[model samples]
Every structure is written in C-alpha cells, then in structure tokens.
Target: MFTRKQFVSASVGALVAGTLGACSSNGSNGGSAATKASDDSYTLVQSGKILGASDLQYPPLSQMNESTGQPEGFEIDLLAALAEKMGLESGWIDPIKFDAIIPLIQQGGKADVGLSAFTITDERLKQVDFTDSYLDSNQGLVVKKELTDDAEAYLNQAGRKVAAQSGTTGESWAKENLPNAELVPLDDAIQAMTGVSTGLYDGCVADLPVVSNLTLNSYTDLTVAKQIPTGEQYGIAVSKDNPGLTKALNKALTEIQGDGTLDELKTKWFGSNI
Candidate 1:
C-alpha cells in the first residue's frame, strides 16, 4: 500500500526511531539528565560526569543479576574506579542497543565514553577514537557440543545458520568470513545465546567473555568451537575530537590497570585475568 519513495522514507524513519529509542539519555531526552555538560566548565573536566553505556546484560562486563536483579560486572566496576580516579561523578545511562552506542556518540554526542565490551578494530577506529585496550577478547565460535566437530572440520558451511548481535564485531566477522552461512543478527547477547540453544541457529559468534559466560551459566549445551586470536581487544570509546576526555580516560585506565583493580575484577568474574 506504499509507494516506492514513501516506503524508503518510512524505512529511514524506522531506523531513526529505533536509534533514538536505543540512545535516549533520559525521558524523551528531557530534564537535567538530558542536558549536555557545558564546555566552559573545567569542573566538566575534573568533576564532570558524562553519560556512559547502553544496558547491563553482558555478563562479566555488565549484567543484571538474576537473583538480586542488581547490575554488577567488570566494566561497571572499572567505570566506578575510573570515575573516582578522574574526580568525576559517573552517571548511569539506560538501555541503548549495542550498535546504537557508537552512532549516538558519533552523530549525537549522546555518551561521553562507551564501554560495552566494545572491540577495538581498524574499521571502528575510523568512526571514533578508542581508549587503550582494557579487555582482550578474540573472535570465538560457540556451537552445540555435538556440532562442535562439524564447525572445526568446516570453518564455513553453506546453508547453515550463524547468529550474532547486531552492530557488534561478531556480526561483522560472521558476515565477512562466513559468507556461505546464513547470518542472523539479534539485538543482544541474550538473544544470540538463546538462538543457539533453541536450534534456531547452528552457531553463534561472539567475544571470548560472552562465550565463557554463556557456556558456564546459561548455555550448557554450547561450547567454544574455535577462537580467532589475531590479537583483538576491546576498548572504551569517545568522539574522535574529544582528546581531553580521551586523555583523562587513558590516565584513569592506566591507574586501574597498574593498581590491579582491573585484574581483581577480572578474576572475580572470569576466574582468571584476561
């Protein structure tokens, strides 16, 4: 019932709407919560807190506890330490989709720094500058224990289905490398894990932390089939021009890594320092 031009407009509108829904800082982007910090304020440098992160559901990094429903994870702990070291008050932002986080920062300046287990890559670097590597995670494949051998035998299987969260490095890697496989992009880690468990997908591609977390706690049926360890790592991200913020973040990050807070949190969550 829609004309070609009208359909195109509608599709574009939908994408925008979806992005806004994911990145809205506060209610309808209103109130004190929605306002951006003033550049003239040095307090914005030392004492300023900028919005960060999307949702807290990626385990070991950020996740809401199933028992207590409280949010706790490695990234949250690291952010807390960084905030204290930087003399800034950390403001928590709500549930933005993973892919929307970078776009919001680039186009809208939505968050000051994004730390959602984001992988650092050459392709992503063109869009935004990244903090030094805070977490190292290789591209990994998770498959049913029974089908693990199949994936090991044939790295790419035509007519088979692979799943990953939209806008993530996993999705990009799968699309690029697994060209023969049907790729399904879900919105979050939970969905990707569930898809494999439900037999809706033959395998799921994700970061190592995601593979470990799901295999240990949620998806017992799944196991890591292969790991692409070309030395990929995750980093905190900010707008390219915001060198001041990046510098401050790097200082705080260095302190955390030096004082062993990062490793302490890593061991607590992951059972080993990654």
Candidate 2:
C-alpha cells in the first residue's frame, strides 16, 4: 500500500534487516497470555494472543520488569492496548538479539510482531512489513552532568569517545555528525549509556525517549545534552506473510492515537509527550 515511503536499500533497512522484526517475532518460540484472542481477521503466532520479539533491555520503551520478569514499557502497554482493540490479549515477549529480530520474523515460528523501538525505513521494508508509524523519534545525546559545553560541538572533535548502539540510527547519526570523534558502537542503546556512566566513554547517542527516561530517573548523574531531530518514526514490524495483521494493527493504532492513549503513555513514561 505504502509503496514510496522508507528502508531496505540504503543504510537503514539493510542495516536493520538485521535489526527489526524479521518474522521471528514468529520465528520459533511460543509464549502467549492465558486468554486467547478470538479475532479471526488475521493469523497469529499464538491463537489467542499477539506474541512479540524484543531485545528486552531498553527501558521505558520495552524492557523486562525486574519484579515480574516479563516485558513492560510504552511499547508493551501500547501492544496490549492495540491487541485489546483487535479483540485479542497481549502475548509475552520473547527475548531475542537486537540484530536478529527481522530474520526471526522471516523464519515464521516465534512471535507475531517485533515490539522493539524499530524505526521503520524503506531498507527494513524490503524484509518485513511494518504497521503504520506509531511514535516520532530522534537521536539523543547522553553525557555526564558535569561536562556541559555545547553538547554537539564538544563531542564533535577527535579523541572524544562516544558510545552508540550498533545497527541503530544513533550510530549513523554519530558517524555523520561527530565525524572526528571516536565512536564506540555497543550492543544496545542502554549499554552505550552504561558505558558512559562507568566513565568508559564521554557520551552516548541513542533514541530520545529512552535516554530521556534514563537520565531523568535511574541514571540521575547523566543528562540529555541534546535531542537530534532525525525525523524518524517507530513502527511495528509484522511479517510480509501477514498483511492482514498489519492492517489490523494500523486500525488499532489509529484508534489509540485518536483517543489520546498514545499521548498519555508518552507523558506517563517519558515525563511528557515527546
């Protein structure tokens, strides 16, 4: 339907085919809620639920609840709300590697959708279909609270060690903007922030909502020095084999967006709508 929009050929999709939902969200796992959704419009990984694939470490977006040992965050809550709209229950999140989500979706036995903070692009479109864009996103700079010069300028020089999550747009942004800096690509965005907190790096680049949540709460010593507007939007990665699911999800997403559920979630988790 949306033929001329975003990823697969350039840096984003190709870089993220290894990144978003491949189908493995439906790849080879089985974890669903107790009550099965009775919807019959689309096929699902689990009969009554919408199973998901995730990295499970990024907080406020999607992460494992320390006490519950299950996934929680804006994405998780949004997923439940969307599933309910579709007459289904929210399924459990299967912990998958960051770069392996899309491939797993392609494999067809794991989960129903990939629930990570996936920035939909034409490159990723070549691999898996995406539902309508849910959240507008941008790159963020996380730095130690003590060093507060022009955030971008101070870090745009040689010898400034900056950490970025590998295979994410944040890495690409750092490469293009902080050309002279020593960019360290970590396994995930949170790791990049942790590396900075431990004094291993001067700063880190990652998604805005994620870094914003961390700096405001858990990592109090850190601060969001800058928010780089990348004009990126996050989407749910569904299987190409499951177009029905995509449409169904889009409908539900529209409902939430119209009803202000999305805005409320943003305010609850990120301290304000971003």
Candidate 3:
C-alpha cells in the first residue's frame, strides 16, 4: 500500500490546477512565534511546531489581531491546519517586513516557512520553493472616495502618485500598467491603502480580495475601480533545503483539498468556497 504521504504528494500538483477567485478571510488568532528549535517527523526549525516568517498586516491572508495581540488571518489558519496534519504546532515571525520574508526562510534557523500570501512567480521560485497554490489572485485598482470621476483614468495620468508595496507583484503591475503615474513603494500593503484614503496618493494597486474587503469594510472611502487579472496564485513558501518539510506540507495540502477542509475554511473565512 502506498503511504499517505506518497498518495497525497503524488497527486498534489493536479489538485489545484485552476485558480479560484480568492475571497476575503476573517481568521482566528494564532500562536505566538517561538525560539526553540527541535523536531521529529521532519527536522523542523522548532520541535512540535512549524515556524513561519510573514508580514502580519495584510488582512484576510495574514494580520495582527487587535484584541488578542497575536497574528490572525487566512494564511495563519492555513498554516495551522498544515502543521496539525504534520503533528506540529504553528508559530510565526510576528510583524516582519514583507520583502524580508523569503530571505529569512532562505537563511534558515529563523523560519521553516513563509506564508504571507506570496505569489508563485518564476523569480521567487529561484529563491524559495512554493507549495501548491491555495488561492488565485488579481490586482485591484484602489482609489480615494473623492476620486469619484473615472478613478482609473484619473490615476493613470502623468505625475499622479500611486502606492504599492515594494517588492510585490502589485508594484510590478503599477510599473507596467501605470507607467505614466509615479509609483511610490510602501513597506506594507495597508500603508498603500492608507495613503490613498488620506490623499497622500491618488491610488494604489494590491490584491483584489484584500481591496474588496477593505473597501467594503475598513476603508469605505476607497473603491475598487478595476480588477486586473494577472494570473497570480498564492502559495506557502518553503526552503530548498527542507525537502521533507515541503513534501509533508504538500501531502497535507492535498488532504485538505480532498477532505473538504479547504472548502470549509473558505466558507468560514470568505463566506463561500471559490
């Protein structure tokens, strides 16, 4: 008989072939980051735990819980589920810089994985390995409420300032699509939205799901003027050195897809499955 790992890993890639329209998530508070390093089934950075590096500011995917003072979001819950399947607990690098997440995973000793809604790109694949995509994403054009007249065209004009998180696909999209507009690279995705809300920028580009949630709830002053399909997919980042860990996560991810847990989580957080 094939091992569960063998069965799951074998069909992993086939499981999430087509991307789904990612929806916003509302997550439960997560465990705190730990310092201990030891393990069993796999040589994890920490014993009985999966240590992750992430920027805990992007809502629906990852963010800090105001009430609990801990990380909370879809990615956090997803990581927790993956860890449970591997008989490990989940913890993370609280409030790390978005661009620095991959580097910390590459350096080792700091984190075993990165789960900050990272897009699976050819360039990022060279630096770190990615698990099967969990969600399909697109870029959103977010503009201030006052920019009611043709927000997209208005922001597309020359000298119009646009904000996007540095080192992200949204920034790349702005560079390519909004070439006439000035691109301001912010340190965090929320900062870009805040800048737009406060009139510091005419607009910003970020993940559509995040923009949808924020515009509908947090930043009602902003609006999603456009959903730019970039064919981007989000993945859990694993180190090249940790093949066992990668294999373990892939197996767990496959199980989640097969057993309806993924659908359940999607509904719980996003209000429906994609």
lDDT, candidate 1, 1-274, per-residue tens: 2222333345457557774232112222322123222221111211246557666768778887779866678887788888778665676676688888887666533566788988887878899889899888877788888877758335477778888888888887888888888889888878888888998888888888878887988789888888867477888878765654676677888988899988898898888987
> On residues 50-118, what C-alpha lDDT tens digit does candidate 2 reach at each position?
888889778899888889887888888999999877767887655877778988876666788887889
Q: Which portions of model 3 miss their true places by more than 4 Å?
A: 1-41, 146-149
The number of the candidate with the highest lDDT is 2
What's model 1's overall lDDT?
0.72
The residue-level lDDT of candidate 2 at 51 comes to: 81
Candidate 2, run of 10 with poorest lDDT: 1-10
lDDT of 1 at 123: 79
lDDT per residue for candidate 3 within 117-230, as digits (tens), equals: 799999998999888898888989998766657777787888799999999999999998888899999988899999989889989999887888789878998999888989
User: Of models 1 and 3, which has the larger TM-score?
Assistant: 3
| TM-score, structure 2 vs. true | 0.82
In order, what lDDT does every prediction score? 0.72, 0.78, 0.77
Kindly give the stretch of ten consecutive residues in candidate 1 with the minimal lDDT sum. 38-47
